[model samples]
Target: MTRFGSRIFWCFVTAAMIFSVISAAFPTKAEAITFTPNFTISSEAAVMINLDKDVTVYEKNPNKKMYPASLTKIMTALIVLDNVEDLDNTVYEAPLVVFDELYGQGASSVGIERGEEVTVTDLMYSLLLKSACESAGILAYHVGGESISNFVDMMNEKAKEIGCTGTHFVNPHGLYDPDQYTNAADMALIAQYAVENYPKFVEIATATEYDMQPTNYHEAGWAHIYHTNSMLNRSSSYYYQYAKGIKTGTLDESGRNLITMGSRDGNNYLLVTMGSPMYDADGNAVYLHYEDHKNLYEWAFENFEYKQLLQAGIEITELQVKFGESSDFVRLVTADNYSCMWLSTVDTNRLKETINVDPSLLNDDGTVTAPVAKGQKFGTYTLTLSGEEICTVDLVAQDDVTLSALAYNFDKAKQFTSSIWFKAALIITAVLVILYIIIVAASKKKRKKYRRVKKRRKF
Candidate 1:
C-alpha cells in the first residue's frame, strides 16, 4: 500500500477506537420527571421513607414539632422490647398503678380496675392497641421503677438513644404534656427501627383484634378487643394492605397523630403523620393519618423505577505509565454498579463522567509502578445527569500493577525518556488522550445514527 494510504488507514482506525471509548465513557442524559403526590391532611408534619433505598419518598414539614400523643406508646414499646426478656411476665394493677390525673380521663383504657392482675403481654396489648393511659402507667411504674418520674427519665434517655432528637418524653402515655414533643421525621426513624429490628414488636402492633382474657382478679376476660390504629380493621382503607404495626394518638392540643408502617412486596415504608384533625366539618371524624400515608406509598410505586447504568468492577479505562516496569497501562474500574431512578425517554446523552486523581500519584520520574492491588482506590469517577451530580464511585485498580526493580531503576537510572517516572506518567496521560479521541468519534457516530434514524422515519 502507498505511504499516504497507510497513514490515512491508521488514522481512520485510531479515530474509530477513540470514538468508541468516548461513547462508553459518557452516557446520555437521564430525564427528570416531577413527582406530585396527592395528600390532604391538617397534620403539622409527615414523612414517608422507602426502606429499601433509604430515601424519603414524600415529606411535608417533616421537621415540625408536634405532640406525639399516644404515639409515644411506640417509644415505650421499643424500650420494653429492648430490655424485657419475658413477654408473658405477670403484674398487678393496684390503685398505685393508676395515675391520679389519668384514671377518670375519657382516654382509651384497658378497663383495669384497682387490684387487677395481668400479664406483661396483656399490658402491652392494652398500652399499644387500646392506648390505655392506665396500662402505660402500670408498665412504667412497674418496669421502670417504683418512681414514675424515674421511668419518665428512662423514656427520655431511650428517646435520645434511638436518635429521636426532637422527641422529649415527660410521660409514658402520650397524653398531651406541654413539655412532651416529637417530630414526624424522628418518629418515622424510631418506627422504622422497631419494624426492622424487633419482629415481636411488629406482630403485636399490627394485631387487628385481641382477646383480653380475665386474670385471677377479673373473672371474666374481655372477649373481643379492637386495635387503636383503626386503619388496621378498615377494609375500605388503602393503608390496610400495607399497614404494619404502629401507634395512633389524638389529643385536643396535639390533634390526631399516627406512626405507621406498611410493607408491600417486601418493600417497607415508615409513614408518620402528626397533628391531623380527626374531626371534619359537621363534626364527622376521619382517618386522615392513613390517607396521608397512602398518598406517599402510591407516589413511590407510580414514579420510581430502578435501572442499572453501569456494571460493578467493569474496566472503564486504562492509563499508561512513563516509568513503569512495562510499557502497558493500568486498568481502572468502577467501585460498584450504578442503579438509579430515571424517567422514560430520558436523554442519556447529557450524562457526564469525570475521572479525578491526585496529581502527585504518578512517580517523581512521571510513571506509575505496577503491582497495584485489586480494589485499591486510585481516584474517583463521577457521573452527572443534566449537570446535577448523582453518582460518584472510586476509580479502583482493576488488578495489581507490579514493577520489576530493574525496570524501575533502568528507567530511573537512565535519564532516558525525560525521567523514567515522568515518561511513565506520560504513558498514563496517553490514555486520557485516547479517551478524548474516543469521545469525539463516539459523538460523530451518535449524531450520524440519530440523523439516519430521523431520515428513515421521514421516508
Candidate 2:
C-alpha cells in the first residue's frame, strides 16, 4: 500500500477507537425531569418515610411542635412492652384513682371498674386499639411499680432514645396537657422504632377488633374493643386495604392525629399527620385525618416505585489493580443488591451515583494493589437524589486477583531501595568500609617505615 493511503487508514481506525471509548464513558443522556408532587393535603403537620430505605418521601411541617393526642400510647406501649416481661401471664388491676382521673378529665375509657382484673395482653389491645385512657393509666400504674408519673418519665426517655428531639410526654394516655406535645417527625421516628423492635405491637395495632374475655369484675366481658384508627377498619368508609396498625389521637387543642403504616408493591411506608382540623366552620366535626392519610398514600403509591439501583455480580466500576496476576484492572461490584424508592414519573438519569474509595486501600497513584479477595470491600457507592444520599452500598472486588509473585517481589525490592531508611543505611555502610580501608593502609605504611628504619640502625 502507498504510504499516504496507509497513514489515512490508520488515522481512521484511531479516530473510531477514540469515539468508541468516549461513547462508552459517557452514554447518551436521558431526558431530565424534576421531582415535585402535584398533590395537596390539609394536615397541619405531616411526614412520610419509606420503611425499606428509611428515606423521607414527603413532609409538611414535620418538625412543628403539636399535640400527639392518643398517639402518645405508642410510646406508652413501647415502655410497657419493654418493662412487662410476661404479657399473657402477668395480670394487673385497675386502681380507683385512675378511674377518678379519667372521669374528672372527661377522657375516654374502656369501662374498667376499680379493682377489675385483666391480663397485660388485654390491656395492650385496649390501650392501642380502643385508645382507652383508663387502660393506659392501669398499665402505667402497674408497669411503673405504683407510680404513673414515673412511667411518664420512662416514656419521655424512650422518646429521646428513639431520636425524638421535640417530644415530651406528660401523660401516658395522650390527654391534653400544656407540657405534652410532639412533632410529626418525632412521632414518625417513634413509630418506626416500635415497628422495628416490637413485632407484637404491629400485630396488636393492626387488629380491627379484639374481644376481651370476661374478667373478674364483668361477667359479660368488656365491650369488644374496636380500633380507633378508621383506616384499619374495613367497614369504615375511609378504610384503606394497605393500612396497618398505628394510633390515633384527638383533643380540643390538638385536633386529630394519626400514624399509620401501609404496604403495597413491596414497599412499606410509615406516615404521621398531626393537628388536622377537628371541626369545619359549621361547628360540625370533620374527619380530615383520614382524608389526608388516604390522599398521601394514593399519591405515593402512584408516583413512587422500588427501583433496584445496583445488582449483585454486575460490574459497577473498574479500579486499577497494581501487580495483579491476570489483569491490570479489577471490576468492582456490590456484594448484595441495593433497592430504593424512586419517583416512577421522573427520569432515571436524575439519579446520580458517587463512588468514594478508601485512601488506605489505594496506592499513591490511586490504584488498588494485588491479592484482592473476591468479596473485599474497598470502597462505597452512594446513590443520591438531588445531592442527598438515599442509599449506599459497599464496592467489593468482583473476583479474586491472585498476586503475581515476580511483580510483587520486584515492587517490594524497588520500594525498599527507594526508601529513606535503606538509603541512609547504605550511606553509613559505605562510610564505615572506607574508614576501615584507610586505617588499615595507614597502619601498613607505618609498619613498613619502621622496618626500614630498624634495618638502617642495624647497618
Candidate 3:
C-alpha cells in the first residue's frame, strides 16, 4: 500500500477505537441510589440491617470484636427461650439474692432480696429492664442447673451456631471479661434472629413498665420499671417513634454499647454499635448511641426503598427466533422477584428497569423460541435509580411450553444452507463445471478440423 493509504487506514482504526470507548462509557440507563450518613463516630464497628428483606443497608467495620456489655443479655434471653419448653413455668430464686465484690461491686441490680421467692417471669423482667447483674447471675445459674460456668458455655456455643465467628461469652450480663467480645455484625445477626424467631422475647425487650407482687416471700405490689434502651422513651426525647426495644450495654471498659430495633411503615431495621466511650464530659453516651441509631435509620429509610421490577411467578414476555421448530416465537418469562432502592422518599419513581439476555436466543430472522419452560433463566432484570445501580434479579420462564423438535431442526438446516459461505461455495463449483465443458467442446472442434485438412491434402 502507498504511504498515504496506510495513514488513512490508521486514522480510521483510531476513530473506531474512540467511538467504541465512548459507547461503552455511557450506559443505556442510570444506576441506583446510595444512602449516606450525616455524621461519623469513633466506634470500631457498626452495622444497620433491614430485617424485612434480610439485607444489610449500611455497614462500617462490622466484623471487629468489641465488648458487648449488657447487650449480651439479648442472646441469653434468646437461647433460654429456644431451649426451654415452657415459658409460663415458675421457679423460685435460689438462696442467692446478695451482692458481692465479684458481682462487679455496685453494678446495677434487680433489687431481688435473699429468700424473695420471685417467679421465672419476675427474673426476666429484672434481667432485661434493669440490667441487673444479680438477676443475670441467678438466671444463668438456674438455666445451667446451678453452674454459672456452664451457662456461659451455652452462650458461646449458641453464638457459633448462629454463624457468628467473632463472638465469645464470659458472663450472661456482659460484665467485662477479657474473653467476652462481639462485633457489630455478629450482634446484628443475633438480634435479627431473636426478632425473627421469637415474638415473646420481643415483647419482653420492648416493654417499658411491668408490675410485680412479691410471692409468698413478700407483699403483692406493682413496681414502675423503665427499659435500659434509651431509644424507646420519648421523655428522653430521641424523636425516633419507630424505635423499639433491643438492649443497651455499658461498662468502664466496654464503653457505651447498644443493639436497637425499630420499624417505620413496613420496614423493620436493626442497628448495632460497640466500644463507644459513654458518659464523657462532652455528652451522654446512651444519648449519643441513640442519636447514631436514629440518624442512620432515618437516612436509610429516606434514601432507599424496594421497587419491584418484575412480578413473582409471572411471565413478562417471550424471545424471538428465526428458523426454530416453531416459525415465529419462543416464550420468555421473568425468572424471579425484582426489587431495589431509590434515592429518597421523593424519588421513588426514578428507579428504572432493563433486561439482558443471550444473543443466541434470537434467530437469524430475530424471532424467539416457543414452549419455554417455567422458571428457566431467560435474562437478568436490573433495577436502577438516580445515577447508581441498586439491585439485579433474574428474569425466568413463567410457564412451560414445548415446540416440535423436528421442526426446529429443519428450520436450522435451512439457515445453514442459506449462509453466505455456503452460497459462495456453490458459485465456485458452478464456474469450474462450466469451464470444463467449454474446454472439452473446443478440443473436439480442433480435432475434427485437423482430420478434414489432412484428408483434403491427401486427395
Q: Write model 3 residue lDDT over 187-291, tens digit each, in one string.
A: 988988888888888888878767665666656664556788766777777646888887888888887788878788788788887876666676654446677
**lDDT score at residue 50, model 1, on the 0-100 scale:** 69
Per-model TM-score, in order, reads 0.70, 0.66, 0.67
**What shift in Å separates residue 173 of candidate 1 from its native position after superposition?**
0.3
Best to worst by lDDT, what's the order?
Answer: 2, 1, 3
Query: What is the clash count for each candidate, in the order shown?
Result: 34, 1, 22
What tens digits encode model 2's per-residue C-alpha lDDT throughout 1-459?
A: 234444544454443332110101111112212244676677899988888877787888888989988999999999999988889888998898788777778788887789999889989999999899988999999888899999998998898788999999998998988999989989999999999999889999888888886789877655888889888777889899988878899998998899999888887889999999989999998998898888888888888876776677777888898888998888988667766566887676877987777776776788877777888887777667776656677777888998797987666566666767556656665666677678888999999999999999999
Model 1, residue 382: distance off in Å is 2.8
Candidate 2 segments whose C-alpha is farther than 4 A from its true place: 1-36, 309-339, 351-459
Can you give the lDDT of residue 250 in candidate 3? 87
Q: Evaluate model 1: give its TM-score.
A: 0.70
Instruction: Give all candidate RMSDs, comma-separated.
Output: 20.8, 13.4, 10.7
Runs in model 1 with CA error above 4 Å? 1-43, 52-61, 82-84, 103-105, 221-223, 235-239, 277-286, 302-309, 317-320, 338-354, 362-376, 384-390, 399-459
Q: Put down candidate 1 lDDT per residue, 1-459, tens digits, no spaces.
A: 234444544453443332110111222223322233544655778877767776665678878888888988877777777667787866646456455758566767877776777877888888788888887887777777666778888888877777877888888888778899889888888888788788888888888878876787666656457787766776554436667667888988988888777766666677788888878887997767677666666666565666677778988777665434444577889877777654334565767888776445655664455655567666777777666676777777777666566764554334434545445545655666677778889999999999999999999
